[model samples]
Target: MTETHATLPPGAPAFPPGRYGRRREPRRRRPLLTTLLVVALVAVMTLVSVRLYRQYGDPNYDAQVITYTGITDSQVLVDFRVNVPEGGSAVCLLRARDRDGAEVAREEVTVTARPDQRQVTTQHRLATTARPFIGEVVRCRPPA
Candidate 1:
């Protein structure tokens, strides 16, 4: 009987005698300064995100569809509520949807500023191509 074995070059270090593969040392990791820098970057990004949301993301005002006040064959009437800063006005998008959830009409309505009140209810009328099943206030924002 004869046995055959793989061999290494004369000057090369052999693998550990009893192991199937060479042992590998654990990889080095970044130092504390690099980790802290990444953490600081993430914190800064989070702060900026919150600041931007507060500035332009509807935090200063709120809008809600109070009720579907009325409807006609070609128009929908909605009563919605808005809360705004004192003396600030809000422009709202009122939309009407049919039974299939398709938007039948959309209208932009503006609520006048009321320094004496923070919340107000307003009516909006949207013209539709078909009969509307529901009416809603889609969005409201400060006038540009």
Candidate 2:
């Protein structure tokens, strides 16, 4: 009887040998730290944009006095005007206020006028005498 065995070449693996079938090291990341970094960047950008806009935006105007003439029971003929530049539209926000500055009634009107023009006029019916008339300039813009 003759016995035979399998043979391998020199310097080659023999299936029980070196460095084969090794598990690779896992990569590491800090999830909490990464999320905090993203949040900080967004907050910084928002503050910068708000500051820049306020520096370049237009000036603000508050509402002024109310003027009324030729009053009647149901309707009153009144001239509404706002102090604005040439080629601008005046917005009149009408409201009624008690002596304590509390709002009682409210309405809004817009008027466009050229330079060196007279007051803008609109007629409105009185809703309630319990509230005194309050008028304010809301906005002014060029004619489109």
Candidate 3:
């Protein structure tokens, strides 16, 4: 008696009558490493920009009394020189307050770019009978 092998279906490759080897699939790619590198670079650049801005753009101001002359009706003409960094402008607000901290008079002035010039010439009227007035000069930069 003789032995017979089973038939394979259509379009199927017949097994070779010899030793067999295992097949391997294609390798997969990973994206996690690339994404992490980009995030790290952005964080480093932001820190560098903040440090540079703090160094160069800082503002410094100096105020000096120019003159204090008396005006009529007991008012005084107080002149001041506000010096700011070159090419920068200053906004000056003059305020007169009474003993109770209430605002009696206020004035606003703008000083433009001048290396050596006066900025503000303000006048405050003191009450003849009520209370003595205290004057204050506040200077700042205008909002962009």
Candidate 4:
């Protein structure tokens, strides 16, 4: 029913001068604005990554799940080992998942190291809404 001047063939018949509407000028690109937006986005992401790393990504405190047992409709038993600074303490994240890989429960547990000990082992019973297939230690970080 209609076509733009740019899309018409050279010999294509044209409508009357004022029958339709005038073609507007093409939009101009703003490289500077785009560059500024990109830089700002990168800066914000870097800041967030740094903040998260400081809060939850400490290399000194690490935890691993040793074994999971006692799985039932209402709860699961999680056995884990965590390594922290000698004589220091850490807070660890514990998670439980159902057979379908859906998270069933999560909790934070605190662990401490003895004067000459850097590794601490513990177990926790996590109450869940559904039957859990596995339990794990997500991470360990410095106590808040």
Instruction: List the candidates' TM-scores in order.
Output: 0.68, 0.37, 0.40, 0.64
Off by over 4 Å in 2: 1-57, 60-63, 66-81, 115-126, 133-144
lDDT of 2 by residue, 54-118 (tens): 54433332224456544433333344555455455655556555456765556566665576744
Residue pairs clashing, model 1: none
lDDT of 1 by residue, 49-139 (tens): 9998866688556888878856887998898888888878888888899999999998888897677888878877888999999998877
Query: Which is better, 2 or 4, measured by lDDT?
Result: 4
Q: Choose 1 or 2, whichever is better by lDDT.
A: 1
Q: In TM-score terms, which candidate is top?
A: 1
Model 4 segments beyond 4 Å from truth?
A: 1-49
Q: Which digits, one per residue and each the tens of the lDDT, describe model 4 over residues 55-139?
A: 7777789888999999999999999999899999999989999999999999999998899999999999999989999999888
Angstrom error at residue 26, model 1: 6.5
lDDT of each: 0.82, 0.51, 0.56, 0.90
The C-alpha stretches of model 3 lying farther than 4 A from their native spots are: 1-59, 65-68, 71-74, 115-132
Q: Which 10 consecutive residues of model 1 have the lowest summed lDDT? A: 1-10
Candidate 4, which ten residues in sequence have the lowest lDDT sum?
15-24
